[model samples]
Target: VALADLGRLPVTFATVDPVALIRNAVWANSRRAKAQSVSVEPGQLPSTTVLVKWDGARIEQLFTALIESSLRYTPAGGRIAL
Candidate 1:
């Protein structure tokens, strides 16, 4: 569905917390990082939720892609704070 949306589909925008998204992205990619012995965790986050209007799925995909790319380059025993 996400791939199909790439064909100029209208973005489903809504209020979302970016910090929560970051944490979720970290969790989603943690297993791969563990397999490589690299620590993947969320950095310090704001105490209050930061809301924004955007396509949540696309934002998540972007975060996941960035983290996966980092995992590909980071050495074993390295740390990545998203």
Candidate 2:
């Protein structure tokens, strides 16, 4: 599952916007939160471009997995922060 989640990437790296990326990923999983009765919260991260040259999808998967992991360990009404 981890391998599939981090499926592919280009041979070359590119600058990435982590906030936007995580926002989209969280949005995509919003229904999961409702179903699990847990909240995945994001802090007030700045708009300052926190750029990084890395596997964007992998990084997103890493965070997404962390959130999901929290759901498993946390109580039904618990919260996971990013």
Q: lDDT for every model?
A: 0.90, 0.76
Query: Model 2 — TM-score against the truth?
Result: 0.75
lDDT of 2 by residue, 1-82 (tens): 6545796534446788888778866776678987999887776778686788867777787788877777788888887778
Candidate 1 residue pairs in backbone clash: none
Total clashing residue pairs per candidate? 0, 0
Worst 10 residues of 2 by lDDT: 3-12
| Alpha-carbon runs more than 4 Å astray in model 2 | 1-12
For model 1, the superposed segments whose C-alpha errors exceed 4 Å read 1-9
TM-score, every prediction:
0.86, 0.75
Cα shift from native, residue 19, model 2 (Å)? 0.9
